[model samples]
Structure formats: C-alpha cells, structure tokens
Target: MPSENQGFSVWGFIKGFGKLLIGFLLLLQGIIGLVVMLLIVGVIVSVSDNLAGGKAARVDVPKGAALLLNPQGVLVEQAEEVDPFEKALEEAYGVDEPDQVEARDIIRAIRKAKTDERVAGLVLDLGGLYAPASSASKLHDIAAAIEDFKTSEKPVIAVGDYYSQEQYLIASRADEILMHGFGNVVLYGYGSYEAYIKSLLEKLKVTSHIFRVGTFKSAVEPFMRDDMSPEAKEANLAYLSVLWREYAASVEKARALPQGSVQRYADEMPPLLEQANGDFAKLAQRYGLVDDLKSRPQQLAYLKEKFGADKDGKSFKHVALSRYLKAVGEAEPDGEAPNIALVTAAGVIVDGEAPAGVAAGGDTIAKLLKKAHDDENVKAVVFRVDSPGGSAFASEIIRERLLELKEAGKPVVVSMGSLAASGGYWISSPADEIWAAPTTITGSIGIFGLLTTFENTAAEIGVYVDGVGTSRLSPLIATGVGPLPEVAAELIQQSVEEGYERFLRVVSEGRGLERDYIDSIGQGRVWIGETAQGLKLVDKLGDLDAAVAAAAERAGLEEYDVVEMVEKLTPFQRIFGGAAARAMKLAGLDFAEARAHQSALRKLFAQIKGEIELLDSFNDPSGLYARCLSCELR
Candidate 1:
C-alpha cells in the first residue's frame, strides 16, 4: 500500500529472515546427524571390544567333564538367525542375544554327548530356566537322551535355588535334584485365560458384530459378552483337566512321587508352610518334591567331587550345551545326500509377504514350499507349523500348495509345534501325515468374522450419516457407520458357516475322518496332542525329527540329508529394515504387546488395533477368518 520504496524494504527484510531461519535449521540437522553418527560409532566400538575379548578368551571343556545344561530361558523351536552386523548392533544394546537355547541344538548336543566318553555325566545348573508346557513337551527328546546317557552309568545331577513347573519337569528326570536352602518346587498348574471387553465397548458406544459357526467358538465371546460363556468355560476346563492330569502323571512317573503330591502341595501350601515353620525348602524335601536341600557352595563342592574342577577351583570344567554343539559338528550326510526339505511355517498366517519374526504370509510360505517341490534334490518335505492360526484364505493358500506337492509325488508331512490350531491346523490338514508333540495345541477348526461399527459413538456426538448407496453391501463396515444392516451381517455369517463346512470337508478328506466326527471335534475347541491322536486329528505323537523320518519313510529313502528351507534376506535389507523397526519400538509403536494397565476403553482400543492390523494381512475381501483368538498360551 505504501510505495516502491516500502515494498523493497519489506522484501529485503523477509529475504534476510528466511536466510537466517534456513541457516539455523541446517545447523540443527548437522548436530542431529553428528549425534546419530557418534552413537553408531560408539555402539560399533563397544561391540567390537566385547567380541574381541570374548574371542580372545578361552572357554575349554576338559575331557570327562559334565556338560553344564544351564539354559537361561525358555527353549524356542528355533533360535533367531540375525545378520552379523545386526547381531552386533543388537548385542551392543544387550537385546535378544543368546539368552535362550534352541530345542534342536539341545537335543543334538545331548545325543552327541551321550556317546562321547569324555562326557562323564551332566550337571543341570537350571539357573531359573523357565520352559513352557509345549516347549517342555518338545524337550522330551532331551529327557530321552538323558535316559540313554544313564545307560553309560553317567548320572544327571540337577542343582537349583528354585524350580518352576517346567523346570521341575526336567529336574524330576535328573538322577538327583538338589535344591538350595531357601528354594522350593513351585508347581503352578496350567490354565487358559483371556480378557473380555463387552462392557467397555458398550460404555464407548461401539458395537461388535461377531459371526462365528462353532457353538464353542469363544473367540468372539470376549467382544460380544461381559464374561467367558458357559460353553467356553466347560471346554476350557475339559482341556485344562487333561493337560493338568498329563502333567501330574508325567511328573509322578518321573519322580515316583505319590499321586497328586504336586497338587496337594499346591492346594495346601499356606498350611504346609506353617507346618514346616515357614521353611519352604525343608517342606518341599519332606514332601518328596525334591531329593535333597543344599546351598550353592555345597552343591558346587559335590559337583567338583563328581566332576573335576578347573585350576581356579571355583568354576567346574564343563561343556555348555550350546558350545558343545559347535564342538561336535553337524552330522555329515554320507555320499550323495538325498534332500529332505524342512520348511518352517511359524507365526500367524497372513496373505502376502511378511518378515521373519512370527508373521507368516501365505504367499511367502507357499513360495517356499513350491521351491522345495520343484527342487530335484528335495525328495521329501516336512512342513513345521508353530502358529495359533490367522486368515482362513491364507490357510487355504498354504494348504493348496501342500496339495500341489502331493500331486507332484513329493511327500509332505506336518510337524506341529507348541501351537497349530485353527488356521494352523487348516494348513496341516492337507499334509500326508501330521506329527505333534505330546502337549501341542491343535484342532480349533472354526471360522469367525468380526466387524466393528461406530454408529452409536458418532450419534453420541451429534454425528449422523445420510448417504445413498447403489447396493446394500456397498458401504459394508464403513468407518463412521457400523453394525452393518441385518442382511449384511447374515451374508457374513453365511460365509463363515461355509468356511467351517469347508474346513470339515478338508479334514474329512485329508485325515480320512468322517465329516460329522470332524465337526464334533471342531467347534473351536482346542485339544492337547494326545487327545488329538485319540480324535485322529494327528497321526503320531512325536517331534520334528519324527516327522522328517516319516517323510523319509514315505519317500522310501534310507539315507537323506535334512535341508532347512529358510527365507534369505540380504544384509543391507536386514540392517535398514531392522533399524527402522528398532526406531519404531523406540518411538513407542510396539503393536504386539498391548499395555494392559491402561484405561478399560484404551485397552479395548489397543486390542481392536491389533485385530485390525491382523485383518490388514488377510487376503479374503469378505474377512472370513480361521483365527484362534483365544489360543495364545504363555
């Protein structure tokens, strides 16, 4: 408004300020970059130093030394395989670096150590190893290996401050279990529990339209009702009873304790503690739960007398199970190794491609199977399943590939892990034969459709929807509107019913079981592997090695090398993707672990977020899911 002079002055001021702001921003970015680079460099140097020292130090196990089986944590089916650089980075941060042992390596080492005459006996410094029920079932092989070791007149001695239920299971198999002065065998029985949130949804004015075919399908009950339905409770009790009974029986058989000794100890703990004058360790020994009570020094002295100690007189000369695996290299296949492909199908079954840690996309797993089928060297395939289940369409995709392998004369066998229920079982149904561990969870052959609506919530804030659609189902599950029209809900229910029927048919055809019988067993009811055998859902009760042997037998091969089929990722891809993932975690974006202590509505929303993300991976446009929502057991 002023004049040419005023205009020039204003323009010069704006240009100068803009330049100054840009310079400040550039300086800030440079500082941030320098900080980040320094952090990376520091991490690298720290990791290199630790690794150098470790490599320089010698950890030698002398001959005739008892291998120390001091597992730090639970045994997973497989140990994580990280890229070298990423491993260094994670180790530098002290995150997820060799904290747990693999079941396969444990079994391998025990077997190789059984015959190694230098191995005098085994020392179990359990060190608070917490194995899950399913993991304990998988470690039956380790127990068997120990039994074989006993034939060599070598005792398996266990010494620990305390023993968890699973730890006691392993310790009970030991020739002698030595408990610390203050330690006791705390045996907590097994039970499945899940959170429900119907009241929260009601309070938030959100509605959940759950369509499921199984009468026992309690997966959606948590959303539709305020508490676990009577049917689900009954079903849960039945399975929990079986599992508990099995556990009690096994422990009793191993330790020769009286029937219900563990149960009695658990039930009468308070009074029993009073009876023992509050000495739990003495009570445990008096009750025959432990063989003896000794302090760490006393136990160490005993082990030193049994198995010679090192020159320092403190640490026993022992071979760690993990280190012993490297000592005795993998058994080499003789002559031309006939290939027996071991393809791992671990994690939730999504639709498309997914990464390594517990997200198995259907297309990705199918590709792995197809590759194994097409490979001339692969004479047999063992499909190892460790998922609780996910999308029905994805399960069908994986099952179809197994059928293709069958058509191509490639023997396909399924080896079930801790969990192989619902979608997990769907994929396993098409296998030539199914092998499951004793405590493997399987057979929840049901389908559910979950659709959330926010109609009431919107109306609570004076929001309304008045839109025209060409078709009735056109706006199905729209964001603002929810509780789809009755007709739409019926359509989704019909689809789920059809999927259930399809599941029954698949099991009927594959397992040679009758449809009615399969339906009787389906109904979203989980069963232990032994009950599954009774129901013909599983062929033999065993582990992965047994399944591979079955595959080899089916293929008529006496000598074959077990070839693991794993997805390969380049170092650059792994490093960048992992760094991004770590950044997301650091940014408080962890999706799997929903913060439970939040407000009820917040917790419900977090759960809903997880379900929505799961749905995003599903291939089915109609959202026909075979997920066992209540099947996760820690």
Candidate 2:
C-alpha cells in the first residue's frame, strides 16, 4: 500500500531495531553472568579466609560467668539439609532461622560447664524452646544432664515469659523458676489424632486400594475409614497413657510436688485461672510451679546481682551455650584411641541415597556402616535410630548391612530415640544390644501396601482408557488411568502378607524367641520403652550415652573415643564448610528465630503443604511400606 521509498525506510528501521535489541540482550546476559561470578568468588574468598584461620576469632568465657542455656528450636537427633550457598546468603542477610537443635550439643554444653571453674551458675532462657510430642526421650536426656550439672552445687535458674509443656519439663529441673506477670504454663497430655479422608476421596471420585497385615496397623486407616478404628484407639491409648504418666511423674518429682500434682494443675486449669482472676503468673505462684514473677528488667537485675554484670552493664556476664562450646571445642580422640562409631539413622527410611537430616536412605546408612566396618580404629558401632519407619524394601537393605557388620565381628548397638517403630525396629533387631529411653516409642511391627487411582475422575471427564495385553497383569500398566485389575490387587495383598510374616521371622531369629510369640506382640502395637523392655522387645532402658557405654563395654575397650560418623559432603559443599545444616545453630550461629512467632495462617498453609509433600514422597519400588503413621503423638 505504500510507496517504494516508504517501504525501504520501514525495512531499515526494523533491521536497526533488531540489531539494538540483540546488543541489549547480550549486555544484560553478561551483567548477570558477572554478578553470579562475583557471588561465587565472594563465597570462595570467605571460605578461604576461614580455612586460613582468619575467621578463627577466639570466644572468651569470663571468669565467674553464668552458662546461658538458651536453646531456640525443636530438639532433634538430626536436622534437615540446606544448600550451602543459600545458607551463607541467608546468614549474611541475617534471616537464617535454624529449625532444629541437636540434643547432644545441649547435653555436651551442660556437662562441660559442670566442671568448668570459670562458669559460676546455669541460666535457662527457654522462652523460644519448643518440643514436639515425639521428643519425650530427648527431653528426659537433657533433663538428666541438667540434674548431673546441679551436682556441682551451682545454682540453676530458669527464666521465661511462659513455658510450654516440654519447656516446663526442663525448667522444672531449675533450682528457681522465674516467669513474667502475664505468662501461663499450658500442659495438654499426649494424644494420638489423625485426619481420616476416605469420604473426601470418594467424593473426588478417587479410590485407595489398601492391603495391610496387623489389625492395629492404622497407617492406611485414613484411606479406608472415616474415623480411627477401635483397635487403633486401644493400642494408641496403651502407649499414650504411659508417656503422659512418665511426664507428670518426672515433673512432680523435680518440682517436689505431690505424685498427682502436675495432673491436677493441668485438669483444674480453668478453675485455677478463675481463682486468680485469669492472671496465669499468679496462679503458677499459688501452685508453687514457679518461684517468682519478674518483669524483663527485674529479671535482668536479679541475674546481674547474682552473677556480676558484664562490662556493658546491660546484662549479666554470661557465656551463651553456643559461644562456650566454641571456646572449649568438641572432644577429639587423643592418639590411637579406639573409636566408637556413632551413626544416626534418623527421619523416614527411603530407598536410595539421601542427604543427612532428610530421610534415612537405606544405601546412605549402609555406606556409613561399611565405613565403620572397614575402619580398624573403630571397635564398635552405636546405631541411633529415631524414625517412624517408611519402606519395607529399604528397611531390609539397612538390616542386611547391620548383619554384615556383625559378621565382621564388629559389635553393633542400637539406641532408640523418641521414635523407632515398624521399619525402625526392623533394622535395630539385628543389633547385639538394643537400648531405649524410658519414654522412647518403639515396636510397631506392621506391613502395608497402598495404591491410589483416579479412573473414576478421569471417566467423569469423558476420558476412557481401554487397552489389550498379552498377560493378565498387562492392565496394571494403565493403573491410574483405568480401574486396577483384580489379579493385581490380589497379588499386592499377598505380597503384604509375606512381608509381615518375614518381619515376625526376623524378630524371632534376632531376639531368640519363637515366631508365634513375636507375632503376638507384633500386631502393629506401639509400646513405650519401659513396657517394651518388660515385653523383651528392648534389652534395657537408657539414653544415648548409656548405649554408647554399653557398646564400649561390649567391644572390650576400657578407654575409647566416641566419634559421630557423618556423610562426607561434596566438593562444593565442603568449600563452603557445608555448615548449611540445621545443626549450624549448635555448631556456631549465635542467632535464633522461633516458629511460635509465625502467623497462624502461614503455619496452616505450611502444614497443608507438608502433608501433601509427605503423601507424594512414597517412593518404595514395591509400593510396600512398613511405616507407623499412628506412632505420631500430639
């Protein structure tokens, strides 16, 4: 439509613009690359500085200073993994919130402070501490350490705005308990609760095919029923009641109250609050739960007067738990001492390799055991299990490795943490000795297989799957798109039954008991350590330290060094010190952010996301699980 000159001008402008756009894009890409390279170089320089001892700033512990035990996260055996670069960047931005603290670090700091002449007293600042229902064993272990610390006769004071049930357990060990004027000590005894979603799934036109052995195996109940089965309730209550009694009894003993005083306080909280005009701090004082009520400034003054003020004069002269650990350093083996390899098998068991603090990968754990077996200095191994179990196939992989260690004449001892049920018990059964804390939840021997399909939902959308196969199992290929074949379901159920029988046999052979006797107690029934010991499911009731000692004794080592074996990081991770782990908080970070301060809506969304992710993480090759969903306590 235009003239020849107009067309030529238009073509020239288009060519010029294209060339400019290309140049702009290339410049932008180069800038981005340069920025990335700069970040990497900065990280390298930081790491190099640290390696060359430039970052080795000494932590000084003042004479006559108090040891500040201010743990600021959920206590765990192992923490979740994180990316090293992201971790360092988060640290730089000062937004890193370590979600977990190791029980060993807390115990180590307390034991070290007990004999350190420079430390004058112990101060508990546990306002940010949270303990989940499963941390009963860990809590007791820490409480034991606190008790041992008091033998030095140094005054131990607990200061907090309020105390949670688990927080109160640790605080109860303090010689004097201090609270804010508006604070409350809320305690709800342990209970097991789960969301059953069968009706919801039916409404969504989805089917959940579940095959399980063990009448009490409620792991698949959420898919099969709208509510908990009566058998599950009976079994759960059996263990729940024992854990609650232990909690109350320990608190009562520590606080010097009557045997049932803790229970009475919790049950009568409403009336007690009414009597004190809803002032919880006053109610706590009346019940003798807390010794004094002090505002923040007043609490600071008390500590300063007792321990002597710091140079800044704003607080007492005290060494924080983390700083003091850095000052003293972790214990290292003195020349050629026999090593007791301590390996932690924590989190749900999955099949292949997984990083530490994630799932306990069968292959990953096997590698650690093999490493221990190959080490001439390592005389024995203590396998610490803290899991609710996961895949049956993965569990077998781990159990076989433990057997290999034993065959090599290396004694293997198992120390159960808060949880070691189902698949957890499967691997631990092969140990020379199994030790569990009095409150450790163990023994939910069960097997189950689950398959979910959405054929009905697909058909509702006018999508149909029709296929022909050469064999009866051919239709199984279209499982999620079409209805499952009857033959396939029957075969899966048979496999589950076989897995259960194998579980009973393994326990019988390992424990030297009859298979029938093991079956009687292996009906997916969960048990606390004290009860498990009585049933001969556990050899003794003890914590990790005791288990380590037992391992040492079994290995005939009069003097040995305890070495916690961990997976080696990759080159990139090692360059950044891989201090990216949740354990970094205990390792050296001096900052904390508590999850209790998160918005309720954010927490709800996070919980929902976690639930969806967990369901999606079922990666067993055979679709067979030896997990214990009912073992979780609330």
Candidate 3:
C-alpha cells in the first residue's frame, strides 16, 4: 500500500511539470507571432510611405495644362518627416508635436506654377485642406502670384465644396471662383476667450499671487477675474479691426473689384440668398463671388474638352503641385546651396532639451541654432515659430542664439504660425523680418511667473511645515510654506519688473519702435497680424513664401533653394526607441498615462515624506503673460 501511494505522488508531480513546460512554450510562441505581425505591418507602412514619396518624382507638363494647387496641412517654414509612429503615438497621447509644411515650399510652388510655360492656368482646390496660419499668408501670397500670372493673360480658377471666411479670402484672388451646387460660404470672424480657475483654486485652498506688467496683458486675468477685462477687450478689438481691414483689402485687390465691393458682397449675401429662393450657389454667382456651380466630374470634363486629349486618351494635361514641384527640382546649380536650415520653435518655451510636442526647449533650440550657424552652406535660416510662450529665461536663450545667426551675416526671417504670442513674440522679435497672416495670433509682449502656497490646505489637514536656513528669509521661501516673505516678494517683483523692461528693449530694438511707444503698446498686449503691422511689430502681412523671398532678397540673391534642417536620429537611437515602445506596448502601458501616473506618484511620495518640492507645473501666468487657455485651433 505504501509503494502504490509513492508511485501515484511521483506521477502527479511529473504531470504537473510537463504541463508547465507546455504552457511556457505556448506563451513564447504567442509573443513571437505578435512580433512577426508587427514587423510585417511595419514593412507595409515603410513601403507605402516610399511609394508616396515617389509620387514626388518628375512628370512632364504638356502645354495648355492647368496647374492644380492643392495644399494640405499647416504651412510651416520647414517640412520634416520623423517616424510616423512617433507622430501617431504623440497625437494618441495628447502630446504636442511640431508638424508643419515650410512656408518657403508653398511659395516656391506658387512661383514655379506662375512661370511654368506648359501651365496655362491655376486651380485652387479647397477640399480637405486646412491652411495653417503661415499657410494662410502663403495663400494670399499665391493669390498675388496668380494675379501676376494674370498679367501675362493666363486664367486662375478656384473650386471648393464650401468656403469659410479664410478660404473665400484666398479664392477671391482667382479670376473665376467655382463652388459646388450645394456648398455654402460662411464668413465668421475671430475672438479670444479665457478660462476662469479662481473658484477651483479657492476650493483647493491654494493662494495664487498674480503680479503682471501690461494693462493689456490679460493672460493672468482668468485666474483673478471671471470675465475679460475691459483692457483686454479694448486691445483685442483694436487688433481685430486692423486685421479685418487688411483682409478685406487683400481680397479686393485679388478679385480686381472695387475697394468696398467685396465687403458689400459679403454683407449682402444673406439677403441675396433669400431673394434667390435660398439657393446658396445662385446667390454666390449673383454676388460675383463664384463664376459657376459644377460637380468635380463636370469640371474635369470641361477641362478635358478645352485642353484636348493625350496619346493615352486622358483628357487634358493635369499637373499636380507635388509632381510639378518635383520636376522643377528642389535644388539649383546657380542658386544658393540647397542646405537650408529649418529651426522650429513650436509649443511653449521650456528650459531643457526634449522631443517634439512639448514646448520648444531652450537647450534644444540653441544647440540646433548653433549647428546651423556653424554650417557653411546654410545661406539663410527660416525660424518657424508656433508657440504661446513660456519661461522668460528660456525665451531669452533662444533669442540670443538667433541674434548670433544675424551677427554671422545669415539672414533670419521668421515665419509665424498660429499663437505666436507673449514669449513666442519675444523670441521672434529679433528676426530680420517677420511674416504673419491676417489671422495669425501674435505679439503678446509680456512677462510673468507664479509662486503658489498651500498653507491653508496644510492647516486643514493638521499638517505643518517648518524649516531652518542660514538666512532669515530662506525658511519662509520656496513652495508649500506660508506666504512669501516681504523681502522675497519684493525681490521677485523687482525681477519680474526687470524682465518686463528687458522684453520691451528687445521689441524696441527688433521692431525699431521707440521706447515710449513700445511701452504703450508693449504691456503684454496680444495682436493679430494687421494690428501688429500697424503697430510696426511685424514687417509684412504675408506668409512663409514672403518671408523666404524677404530672406533671399536680404541676402541679395534673386533666387535660392530651400533646405530643411532636420535632426537625424542615430541608428542606436532608433533601435532603442523601437525597443522601448515595444516594451511599453507589451506591458500594456500607454506612455502618456504612464507619465501622468508617475508624476502623480512622485507628488504623493513627496507629500507623504513631508518634503517641500518646487514643482515645474504648467500654469497660466497671470497679468501680461496670460494666454488664452481655451483658444485652440479647430
């Protein structure tokens, strides 16, 4: 009986070990299968991108062909292609990444289209196209280019499913504007809205001391007040008015109409549509806003009939902008070296070097600028700035490096994208020339910093913080304690004041404005491009192409090739990044959530240990430096 029991136990143990080994093998096989699948998908994507890249290869343009100008995405001062997976992940996680098409590229295309002998006309297609602020300026500039083409007796046509105010403004420049039968044109203006956080802070028992310089600098008003300050309202109105006027004038010039006629037409649209039995297309034609109402197939057929058929029986010689640009080539033998350096200062201004999406780090930008400056073939530099602004010291660091470029005799032109306000404007102030669209948000000349205390929260929780230091004011200083000492407060206030003055000095020098005038307009005031133009803050109301033209002109070159500066990640960097991403995915960790969780964990740990920490949290600095928290691009 004992021998039989021992045998049963040994068999049971053997069975258990065998099952464990089989389970382990299955798990390994599953992991290998997943990895192989990912590799296959990666290969497919790579091949697809390669094919898309090949679409830029040269194509012949037959005579009498109409150039199709389809611009998709934001117009940047430079175009860069990092790993698309990185870009996709960043978007998925709600992190900010700088992705834009260079303004110079847009302008170059327009110029080429205008001069191409085989191109008989131009087509402005507004389908699935979102013009970035810089692109808006480029569109206007391209409209002007089309007008220049018209001088040679060529025609320009614009077609769209619907026309927003911005699209209408650009299409107005076409010799003939065409709309879909069911399309609508809505002319809505711009507005700035602030977010109020006073009540939330109050509930949390956190006291915020807001000290700011500019009366028009309402960036900090949301925390202190519930609504827009009278000063902010007045400043925004002034700026918007100037911008609207400029927009109206540009549209008029492009359409070859009377000065006030476009405005009159736009204003009379609602009543005219009512009179036309509510047919939007009919009203558009009646007001001379559109020349015809047609479908895409019909438009294509009409072009085919007009231009004749090719040997392959394809009607008309249609040259896409991408293909046309490729044929023209991005380089020139006699033109300046195709070594164009594109430096992007996008997002908020931060202290250290980091990857795309977050604010432009001072260290990252400075290093890039230094590298570009050192490159002998980089004849000109295009500083593509799209930021709301951040740390005063960081902005200064970037601005200083830009100054170094100017000192080195390289022409620096700024291509302002959406929300180039406050610290954004500060860094851009040093550019040799600034280009902005009528709708571009820019020029917030202001300075601010925050110091928050949770004394009330600590008291409520029956937790007290005590400190001892060498200096009398040291113990009372830092975060999480009682109110700042009077001396320390005075010191910070003075520092802020000094920063404001320095900001004014930079603006005065950059814009060539007087100190008094800058002070009057400078108090952290945000302005649209038109008001900025009137205030002499921006050099021109134009886009990236204009900036590049200005830069080339400044360099005394009639034409130059544009080269985009991109940081090339090493092989090891790419390998490590892929490995890390795969590991995260395997662990079911969403990187963004992981980061937030880690931050919260650190904060909780610090609290539990009764430690005073200087947290570099994202905050809307009040007063002159306060930005529109809810004002994001649609």
What lDDT does the true structure give each of the candidates? 0.79, 0.87, 0.69
Segments in model 3 whose C-alpha atoms lie over 4 Å from true places? 1-65, 75-102, 132-136, 195-209, 262-270, 308-317, 332-347, 354-359, 376-387, 406-420, 431-442, 450-495, 508-517, 527-564, 568-579, 582-634
Clashes of 1: 1
Instruction: Please write out the lDDT profile of model 1 over residues 495-554, one tens digit for every residue.
Output: 889999999999899988899999998998888788899889999998787899999999
Between candidates 1 and 3, the one scoring higher on lDDT is: 1
Give one digit per residue, the lDDT tens place, for model 3 in 1-634.
9999999999999999999999999988987786676666666755664776634455788787777777665554335435655655666666443346544565677677677788887777756445542234445665566667677676777878878777787688777787888887765444456667888888888887766777776766767777888888887777566555667778766656678865676678678768989997787676667888888777666666755655576655667777777777765345444455678887667677755544577788888899889988777888888777776777778899999999999989998875688888888999988987776778777776566788777778887777777886785655565756667667777777888898889888987888889898777777778667877888787666567787887877754577655565533344345755755655558774545534647556545433221134243232123233322333
Best by TM-score: 2
Give model 2's clash tally: 0
Which scores higher on TM-score, 1 or 2? 2
RMSD of each: 5.1, 4.7, 7.5
Candidate 2: misplaced stretches above 4 Å? 1-56, 81-84, 88-98, 574-600
Q: What lDDT does model 3 reach?
A: 0.69
* Clashing residue pairs in candidate 2 (N, C-alpha, C atoms within 3 angstroms): none
Ranking by TM-score: 2, 1, 3
- 634, model 2: CA deviation in Å? 4.6
Write down the RMSD of candidate 2 (Cα, Å).
4.7
lDDT of 1 at 115: 86
